[model samples]
Target: MTDTQAVQTPDNVAPVLVVDFGAQYAQLIARRVREARIYSEVIPHSATVDEIKAKNPAALILSGGPASVYAEDAPSIDPALMDLGVPVFGICYGYQCMAAALGGEVANTGGREFGRTPLRVTETDSVLLAGQPAEQPVWMSHNDAVQRAPEGFTVTASTEGAPVAAFENLERQMAGVQYHPEVIHTPHGQQVLTHFLYDIAGLEPTWTAANIAETLIDQVREQVGENGLAICGLSGGVDSAVAAALVQRAIGDRLTCVFVDHGLLRAGEREQVQNDFVAATGARLVTVDAAETFLTELKGVSDPETKRKIIGREFIRSFEGAVSEVLGDRAASGQKVDYLVQGTLYPDVVESGGGTGTANIKSHHNVGGLPEDLEFELVEPLRLLFKDEVRAVGRELGLPEEIVGRQPFPGPGLAIRIVGSVDAERLATLRKADLIAREELSSAGLDSTIWQCPVVLLADVRSVGVQGDGRTYGHPIVLRPVSSEDAMTADWTRVPYDVLEKISTRITNEVAEVNRVVLDVTSKPPGTIEWE
Candidate 1:
């Protein structure tokens, strides 16, 4: 899902390429395809016919985007791509595109449908909507709708906004729907996607967690060679931990796991990596105490990107130094560490603009923040995997529940959690607040319900509040509790009032230099889950 295209995938499964037309859920569509046990990836819409054919894709999925089919400069695909003998499935904007490209009619009928709408199936013999009920609700977001089916296609379904909402040509092995079938809001979305992948495209479901583990382990073993050595930096998160575990399984003692206590992690994270992870996997461990070094590099830095890049550079330096200390003369003579293992996930790569035509949201510490002079080749086993898939692999590897089910933690650590300059004092304050939030969420059994609750310290912002009997001006702690499948799109978790009250009350009472506790109710677009 992240940079694993064409030549990179060592696995034998032919990939299902998702043609991204600048839609937000392009990655989601790819994930859904993978969920169907079909290896899938996203390709830019600009990819030429021959460029796409080189991958020898099992099928091609056209992702929905924010564009009208009839626009003068609308995104267009080469007509020859349709002539290829492969199954094609399009959604929303993609449906309109397919219709217009096949000489069907498309126009803004002034009928706009957003959110869950009732879809009426017109044909029961449809391939995509086969055996489905006559009436069902589907998630739709579009304006310009397809008005007619092309020469050999059948109009299967329709909505109030558009008449030709779903169309398919059985002989050509092509199908499309105007509604988003990848989201949970549409009850039968997965079923329809499965139908297309299986009944129409004849794709097999081979992307299970066990299969993923075996494939990734094989890839790591092949890349690291028989005697090559690799070092993985443990970030105490599932991504890094899973990546380390994969490398350890690939080349047992040759993989040295480094725990860099950069003074930016949570209170008990260093201990978790030093004790729990070691006990779980018996990985060759090298602990690097670079807290002071990280603070020095991050001194006077408040910009999120700057902080991320600095931390990334220092992390590589820490690994490079550890290589010399652990390997000694061997490193000097030629047995230098050949790889730097990172727990880089697909979301990290996507947010870092790993996709074509994707804008950089923020530089993830492991992905976009590394310096140009890095000598070790990055072995990101989890780069093509998402956070959820990484967890599955960790569980498959028999790691402990605590390590495998740990919450999502940013690689930049507490530096980005503090919205201002990160000092020892500020880091301490955020750690305390973060710990309390985690404790409360876990105690309430809400850990399984919500994705992550980021406790941010607004170091530059302070307000006046009465502590006991005196006016106390202290920094505010913002609690971001969001629920998401992947870190891509998130919604504010609808946590119970009692749980929020407990977290807020505990942080205000226990943590010093902080009196105000505010909840960030905004979602991903209007605001990111992290404050910085």
Candidate 2:
């Protein structure tokens, strides 16, 4: 059956299933699966064979984790799943799991391999290595190695340190690889993954943003049928904007977008949301000016989590008020709005323990902190997509580059950037400094080179400096420039001296209240992109 037919068959039918073993790259694996144009979902490794079988997956992928196969509490695969008829591919610790569960031995070799490694395919007849060269560079990160293959499995490839680097069981259509093919460190990772998905598993590479849009439109039509109006919350970010546009395409005039200007946004942000979004999608929009409400709630709050909670509570009230206004107008015409759409993405779901049922990290307002007693059914169109894929879909739906390619902005806005309490004066000072930094970065043609350059203001701290041959005390603003593949982990970008000089000069000269401009040289592990 075709992919669409497979999805339509039942909830049990997914083209691919990724078994997440608490790996940081588990989310990346899901992304790769969708890249292959086949629907995939993440389930915990603790899931039983019957549970996996109920999903009716065409193939199974085991994700790599930090744990060693020799650990006492290491994750294991179900023997029943191995006996199942579906094709299976194991990666890293997953390969060891397969070996240990199938009468093979895994031993810690006292030698750990990390990062990029080379593998040699001794046997080219194996289906997994059919089109690949005899020797290729692959990524490896493991402390244990499989000493032997299970009954019917044969070694297909090996590295200098690893003997069972690659193995296959053609009769069962099962394979395992010690290296990580999902990471970019491996040169031909995607190519290898595509080979298995298309050649070995026989999946079609028909997945594209256009196909996703079309399928979702049909599903939305069936779910809402006729005469059901949907309300969308537009954050002016790419996710929300794209979600709004897609829903508009699905139901046309029946969709209403609510844009909240929380007074906490950067310079020109509100106007961009008001003019650019409406011009691009032609959807009916209700712009709510809740700047006063946000500022009022954030009067004396300084703690980051406290500020987040207060702002979140106020936002919900403001949005509910907007929804009520829409309903009040619709009530005059005897129409009822039944859905509330959000721009939640796949990472949000995965981070919320869609796989392992772990506690979610409470960093954002939208993830799992929504009020449970709401009245409208949730509509998350972008829940199955990544950030880049969302951008692609936005382009396919004809959204403006300003709306589609805009960098990610936190919902808390400047409140989080200011280390202490927030007010009009502090926010204005930060905005001015931030604008200078952004202007200089764009002028240097480095906008796309960095993920985001957050200009932070130390509102409570002041530094001594000389201006016009006099001692002056003013707050210092910090420039945080980071480079990232996904927002999960990031590294500080080494900005050129010329670019830094230009930014520093502009911020110090134009912004009168600021005396100094400092650069943040910390990475994501020790410090997040934002100070708060």
Candidate 3:
């Protein structure tokens, strides 16, 4: 409940625990749960039975993984979990584990049903598959199959690879599916999850945007007290803008939104924040010109984490200094700014190792890169919400779509977009190339089709190219376009060939320092959306 990344909501927030089996999809499952207006968290499979029981969860979900249930080192669950009397739903690998744990027959099968598979419902009136198609397609990725149902459970669906594709026990309020119902590839993923939560788990949908905004405002009011002053780092991105708006709502006129222009932002971003944001939110604004300081601190730094850490430290320092700008004649009143508001999302928290068993993917400036001598207490209202959920809350607060629907941008800015050293020359070059790309994408009407497309400047790597009928060596622009429900998981977007060609052509023709443009087709698992 303090200034941490923990999920703090109203006292009525129902806690749903997701048992992660060491897969990236675990977080995706948690997001889906939140999409249904329910609160969920991912706990590692290594959690002890007592540790899980201590949470006194409203319900439990088991996530899918790559390992077989019978493998020697494969992760296993405590059999006692099934007897906890909570409605449990399992997917893919989780389904197999629960089957094996409950004395069901699991066979090696020597066959794998991956990607999309046809599922035949053997029981149309089944609890889990209720009202679902008799024969439909479901996403499957598993080597082992459940051959028999656990006692008191009815086998409802079957696939060519997994005969026991779906099963449920209405009396026990437990169910599972051999195929994954959490992925978008499954046509009825969300509907299936909704059925489980509303019918089987008997949970109420109380996590609406209105409820979320009201609860967060009340919590911020309690934390800041009567006379406390807060300063939010107002980056141009939607996350920071919404966070600033949310905090301003909690304590009107007392919250100062400080925007530090680090000079690494894309074109027109400064104007967007300086004019559009203030016109929309009407919050007290202070602009700090720290571009030279950021560029100097990052002059010889090429490591992504180092740049992020440096930026994070400088951001706090800037916020601390801006305290005086908003104080004015009240400086002698002795009221100090002690709170720093941020829009740290849930994906940032998981990617920064805030969640159990999640790898430290990268150091997000606000989450993992905060300096040891931080001066202000952190108040991250959107820290527990996903990207989509944050947008919904922004709309609920009556924020303009221009600020709320803006693409996701890193807190460290264009410094991270450049793959090499940080300097003015590289920053200017990347900014030009990035502008062209953004302009092209918008013109092609593909802005909403894919998520943010990062135009990276490979400062350290140059390629030979011919321009203006002469040979020249210049940097190559890497275009990374990905599609996703949330930033937690992403797949490379297959933009039309014409759009790609136009983007590449415009960048090469407009950017003088470079000659080539390249498209990155790697997805989230193997490569992150951002190059660094």
Candidate 4:
């Protein structure tokens, strides 16, 4: 659920369009709609009427944004949206915009509602609030409130500060709520949204993982025909593994997976990909031991961006060599390779300037950091999916739990985990500390609670400590355990002190080079999950 909308439109399923108003709730709204078994898409608030009409949506949902309707640069809706003859639901900022666009009175109330507020249902017959509790708590975040309803709309619900908290126009098939219904903080929120989708818009629940998998497989086969050979880069993580598995299903033996060991991976990862993935899919696999090559190239490079670019460039070079070798044997038999497979997910696309109003944060090695003269066309099967959706597809394809449920690891691997220049010694030190943390967390059955614990090696920094009888200086390890729905935003996990003590003690005792361990208590805004 990155801000990215689905690029490939599902052919026959009815799509519900969720217009994003630069709100954080836009992705959450689309996800909620999907939870109801209905398909949804997100578009920017600046989308024109015709652009939205192009989606041929069954219903239109306006998402809440962090703008005031009366502000100079506030995002407003097109008046033509009201005449689209489709059911429309507006939340928060969308509500204010819709009200102002439909000739209703909206004023900037000095009393702004910031948190949970109670709503009193006045109209029981209203479609949005039908069969729900008369009094319910809803999440509210807005500065302006609707002062009066439009001519034909009825004010269905009210709060203490705002008389027009909710309103609906039955004849026009349009409604609005000043409070956010997409957040789980609002208890009957999903039900209200479901009512609008199924009961009002007449949309059916046809979006499923199984159907999506079949469709993607057909798409891949159509892209790479009967004779073309496709090669995938396996990183031993779920994203690439799942993408390769799907492509393998599409083209069978025509797909060759190339894995480059850059020496930045964690313990037991290489074996997992070489053994488990190959056995599960029964596809052709090629393993390249390029650890020394990567380390040599990254000898003095310390900047994160530079390291990522070098890794990406070297990866392409390594992959191209593998492809050429694989194709050389094929050329003797008159076959040519045409496609290079990548595991680029939707968030990678969005964060790299694909989404409507997003800025380029960092270059994902596989997507934005590829070299200019790449040889083959890309066959990215997981390009349009989120991580969870990719995992579901993995399960649907009968992949083992170890590969499917594996946590996300960066493409640059431990190179990004080390805050300084990477070397064999630093990698080994980080690996040992990382292994201890992972093993202890898993043993405590807290793996599910922590999204990912990036054990970072402060390779260039050293602190003084007393070992047996003398003073010793050693590097410190930073434990960054996070909890998140996606990698976009994350909060530090609150692991029990006993568990943390175990991880700290084990790493300090087992790994000689590591003396102290510190916890990263910062969230995503101030710091990323990975140090580098």
TM-score of each: 0.97, 0.91, 0.95, 0.92
lDDT (tens digit, per residue) of candidate 2 on 1-532: 1122112322323558788787877667767777777777667787788877877888999888878876778777777788788988888888888878788878887766888888898887877877788889999988888878888898989987788898888777778898998877887777777777877777876657887777666666666667788888888888889988878887888888988788888998888888988999888889899988889889888887778777766666677787767776678887777887778776655544443443354445555445556666667777667777788889998888988888888767888999889998899999988888888899998888998888899998999988888888999999999997656567899999999999998888888888898999998655767887
Error of 1 at 359 (Å): 1.0
* Steric overlap count per candidate: 0, 2, 0, 0
Tens digit per residue, CA lDDT, model 1, 1-532? 2444212544687889889999878888988888888888778898889988888899999999998887788898787888899889989888778787788988887999999899999998887898889999999999888888888999999999989988888778899999999988999998988988998888889898999999999999988899898899988888888999999999998888898999999988888778888899988788999999999888889998899989999999999889887676676677778899999887777777776557788888887888989899889888788778899999999998998887788888889999999999999899999999999888999988889888899999999999889999999999899998878778999889999899889989998799999988998876777876
* Model 3 lDDT per residue over 1-532, tens place: 1122454434556578899998758988888888888988888898888978877788889999889888899999999998999889988888889989889988886778889999999986876777778989988888889999999899898988888888988788888988777888999888888888988999998888998899888888988988998899999899999898889999998898999998888999898889998999888789999999898899899999888999999998888888888787768988788899998988887888775577889989998889988888898888788888889999999998988888889888998899988999999999998998888889988888887888899999989999889999999899998897788778888988998898888888888998999889888887877877
For model 3, where is the 10-residue window of minimal lDDT?
Answer: 1-10
- In TM-score terms, candidate 1 sits at 0.97
Candidate no. 3 TM-score: 0.95
lDDT of each: 0.87, 0.79, 0.86, 0.84
Candidate 4 lDDT over 1-532, as tens digits, reads 2333325556565678888888775767877887787777677777789977877888999999888888898788888988889889889888888888899998976868888999899998888889999999998887889999888999999988788999888677788898988876899888888877877677788777898789789889988998889889999888988999889889988888999998889998888789988888888789999999999999988988888889989998998888767775677887778898888886777556555465566777886678888888888887766677788889999998888877789899999989899999999999999999999999999877888889999998999987888788999999999997656567899999999999989998899998999999998756767786
In candidate 4, clashing pairs total: 0
lDDT of 2: 0.79
Q: Which 10-residue window in model 2 sums to the lowest lDDT? A: 1-10
Question: Candidate 1 at 263: error in angstroms?
Answer: 0.2
